[model samples]
Target: MTLNLENEQNHELPSDCEETARQVIRQVLASENCPYEAEVNLTFVDNDEIHRLNREFRQIDRATDVLSFPMTDWESPANYSCLEDDETAAGSFNPETGELLLGDIVISVERANEQAKEYGHSLKREISFLIAHSMLHLLGYDHMVPEEAAVMEQKQEAILQALGITRDPEVRS
Candidate 1:
């Protein structure tokens, strides 16, 4: 998988933030059994930028911790069979790299830091959690309802746990 990451914000992020994001994305894809070599774009932004994005794209006036913009809509999460059959399949693959273009993820580092403090967790854990959650969305997972939310929560926790990142930094399983 190829991850194109850009840090547009000036926050003092963790030194290993980029690697952490790559690891979380890989874990999510592995857990979902994604079939293709994937490519994704990740951008870190400040709260103002995120707030603008949230309002423009989602019509939400408030800023969120993370935003996911998936390239394809799937019948089932991470099922790439439909893409293979699609007439636009040629457009889905990266021209030079030949990897399936997953989508773009925009994260608000300022918001994540605030949430980490509010939730009593390390910044690394909070950022990792956002990456995992956004990856699930890119794979077509949603939390519109309780059942879906539960599934997403479970999957997010599993992904983080696999990376030894948890809500409580003192504990790891």
Candidate 2:
């Protein structure tokens, strides 16, 4: 559950914001009923970097939002292989780093700022939500179906609430 965050940006954001993001992601992982520890590489980049990545990796021409690169594609439990070593990736545990490989999540800080303004929330909250959402995707959770979407969304809200990240909540005076 260790997050090796590589902040590849010069944009200004609150100090400890990355740690807050790490905490939220860890919270979700701890509550998740799964096996194997996965290492999450969160890269904070600008819009251009994300856009280029979006085009190269996803074959899209635009960078709309967050992108998730899952380690494997075990969509169904019948074909599930969590108990075994993943064929799609290097071993979850790396001796050099002593961390599980959970794939990567690239986020656009520039876009996150715009989203915060559009959504009427602080930038911290918006970025935190995106991190949480991407973490779920890393854990094989998705919102492709209505039922599955509800469960995933519920988990997201619960994590955010658990972190006490709310809209305009009174801070200690």
Candidate 3:
């Protein structure tokens, strides 16, 4: 698995924050048991750029925290059609290096920072949740229906909890 993180805009994100993000991503890749080599892009942007993307792609004309574009063969629930299965096992042969590109995830720092405040958590927790959520989306996991969403939510929570990142009240023992 390859992680390509690019910060084009002027944002002074801490090094620790970026490392933590990468660590979470690595764990996800390993846990997924993805056989073929994969490449993913992580981009950080501002509210304006993310809003434009939301309007253009989703046509919602609003801002969002994260956006994922998966380039693979995927056929699952109809409502989550926004995802394309990048499953290397599904005969999605990457012609070039026989490696699949698992699409991109763009995050709005502005939104994450704001949400952390609203959620009464650190920016680190918010970023971890966002990364985990988008990674699940990349793997074609969705909450389009109640059942599917519950499954995905449980996985998300499990991953976060394993990483010691949670939504629970602080456990001061």
Candidate 4:
């Protein structure tokens, strides 16, 4: 697995954020039993940048915590194709690693920090959850429907738990 992380925001993010995100991505991929070597590009942006993206890509004029742009057609959790090798395709596989370029994950650092305080958890935990959630999205998970949301939530919680990231007690009860 190769993770390409970029901080496009001016926020003072944790120095270890990139490593944390990589670990979360690995855990999510392993839980899904993904067979192919994978590569992901993650970008950290501020609310304004993410808001612009949400408007342009989703036609929603609001900032979102995270957005995922997947590069594959997912047939199932276990079966999916990296973008076609044709140059006409949107993205290509990495020649050096032979890893499928999974796609990009954009996160709003401003929103994440606010959420961490609102939810009474560490910033690290919140960012880890966001990365896991975005990875699932890249791997064909959607939570638009109740059933799908339930499953996605379960998978996210499981991944976080496996990483020893749990809700702060004050936030829980």
Q: What's the CA RMSD for each of the models? A: 2.1, 3.1, 4.9, 3.2
Q: Pick out the ten consecutive residues of candidate 2 with the lowest summed lDDT.
A: 77-86
Q: Highest lDDT, which number?
A: 1
Q: Candidate 2: deviation at residue 139, Å? A: 0.8
> What is the alpha-carbon lDDT of model 1 when measured against the actual structure?
0.90
Off by over 4 Å in 2: 75-81, 85-90, 169-173
Error of 1 at 118 (Å): 0.5
Rank list by TM-score: 1, 4, 2, 3
Please give, for residues 5-108, the per-residue lDDT of candidate 4 as tens digits. 88899977766787788889999989988877899999999999999999999999999999999887666653554344365234546777788778999999
lDDT of 1 by residue, 1-173 (tens): 99999999998888888898999999998999888899999999999999999999999999999999998877888778878875647778898988988899999999998988888888888889999999999989999999999999999998988988878856321
Backbone clashes in model 2, listed as residue pairs: 39-100
Clashing pairs in 3: 72-85, 72-86, 73-85, 74-85
Q: After superposition, how far is residue 72 of candidate 1 from its true place, in Å?
A: 0.6
Tell me the number of clashing residue pairs for each predicted model: 0, 1, 4, 0
Best model number under TM-score: 1
> What is the C-alpha lDDT profile of model 2 across 115-163, one tens digit per residue?
8877778878878888889888877788888998898889889999988
Question: Where is model 1 more than 4 Å wrong at Cα?
Answer: 170-173
- Report the lDDT tens digits of candidate 3 across residue range 40-136: 7899898899999999998989889999887654564222233244443444444666665677899898888788778877777777888888887
Model 1 RMSD in Å is: 2.1
Where is model 4 more than 4 Å wrong at Cα?
A: 81-92, 169-173
* Model 4, C-alpha of 163: deviation from truth (Å): 0.6
Residue 89's C-alpha lDDT in candidate 4? 31
Winner by TM-score between candidate 2 and candidate 1: 1
Error of 4 at 90 (Å): 10
